[model samples]
Target chain A: MEMDSGERFIVPPVNVRETADQIIVEAEMPGIDKNRLEIMLKEKDLFILGRRAKEEPSMGDPVWQEIPHYDFRRVFALGDHVNRSSIHASFDNGVLTLRIAKAEEAKPKKIEVAFA
Target chain B: MQLIRRNRNTTPDLGGLERLQRELSDFFDWTTSAYPTPFRTFGLLEGAWSPALDLYEDKDSLRVVVELPGLKKDEFEATVHGDTLVIQGERKSESEQKKENFYRVERIYGQFHRAVTLPTPVDASKVKASYKDGVLEVILPKKEETKPKQIPVTIQSE
Candidate 1:
């Protein structure tokens, strides 16, 4: 989803790992509501978009600011051999986890060696 | 090496100095190690990590917000001592994959301890804290005596 004009965005930190048959991507996006998050797969790219609900006016004026009050956006290039159709995602505790399975061609194959 | 891309120029950006510092750090991090230890694990070795904090003040209260993604409600502790608010917690790694299995690891883990002094005196008994969506918020109500009071000026006619 596209943010409104003049909206700011922060790049959420991510951790990517590969297993024998699948790849895992975890993005940390604190303060974002589940309904405001979107994950899209286009061609060979995986996109994650999220926006935190605007702070309440009663939250008061900022005395010390460290965390950015901006939307979250990050993209990762999916490997060519990943199974885009079989990708799965889950959100919990403000973390978005995506699991993309590797296609058969990408999995390791053991060849039989025979005496000839 | 450029598998990950961040959004730039499409939206309002951070201050130039902050952006430059972040870019420089990212560059050094990408170039320093053969494996590019993103999270470093050095904070874990040092026994403590400090989470980012934001403090806000209004007429009635001081609000403290902490960024602590992936932590369960039970994983952290928050307390107020005198005029200081202290938050201490540990965020364990979610995946137990081997070191080499990671293509990139930028998420921080291990223990974290953060403390911030409240600007004005607060009523300790009315303080409240809650955790939601990986963010921790603590609200401390200002002391009744310290709250601004308007005294009516009386005119004495001679």
Candidate 2:
């Protein structure tokens, strides 16, 4: 059931960080069920979709409201430095975390200095 | 009852055509870089953040729902003082690893406090709260004396 009218997809706030071996992306999506989350990878793009569960009309008469019930959607343009085949996603406590391994060439290569 | 969607924008709703146009433009700009600025939901004051909430009132009780993602049950506190309900919490970063290179940092983290004044007096002793899936819901039952009383309509004949 759709709560709001219009074709608006709430762009969830996300954090992207890079570590030595992988890139991490975390997106906050509350009120979302585990089964409703979808992660897809196509070519060089990764997509995340989360459909919020329908809110039951338990409480009557809303006095003040600001929270939205729209579905969440985001697409990330992955670079060649990321290994798409090893990408992993996990959703816990309403936070979706995606871990993408760095490609071999992207990893930091150490150069040893030769004593002359 | 049909839910009335209150539009915050003063501009008139242009119906489906306007929506289609917006969707077309969004489709063309699929990448996040195309957006000039990332969406920033900051609090009124600096170095603070407040979560969005909803307030609902029924005949028997009032329900308040606050969105506090990435928080554990022990991290927040809620209290009722007089006719005001206060909720305070802190959101710490998830990872303990040393953060160095960040491609994008849009999530806000820090202390937050929200105080809501109730329209009617409630029985604070009976108030209940529950947290699940990053959302906190507080239910406040109305005082017995404040509940609306229905008087019986009687007709008397002399």
- Best candidate per DockQ, number? 1
Per-residue accuracy of model 2 over A1-116 as CA lDDT, tens digit each: 12234567777888899988999998988778878998987766687889876765566799989788788877788999989999888887778899999999999988999999
TM-score for each of the candidates: 0.77, 0.79
Q: What is the fnat value (0 to 1) for candidate 2? A: 0.69
Candidate 1 Cα errors over 4 Å, as ranges: A1-8, A54-57, A109-116, B1-48, B95-100
Docking class of 1: medium
Query: Model 2, which residues run further than 4 Å from truth?
Result: A1-6, A55-57, A112-116, B1-38, B41-47, B93-97
Q: Across residues B30-129, which tens digit of lDDT does each residue of candidate 1 receive? A: 5563222233322222324567788999999999988888888778998888877878877776554354387756676666677787788999899999
Docking class of 2: medium
Query: RMSD to native for every prediction?
Result: 9.6, 8.7
TM-score of chain B of 1: 0.67
Give per-candidate clash totals: 0, 0
TM-score of chain B of 2: 0.69
Candidate 1 lDDT tens digits, A8-80: 5677778888888888888889888899898888767677888776664568899889887777887677777
In model 2, pairs of residues that clash are none
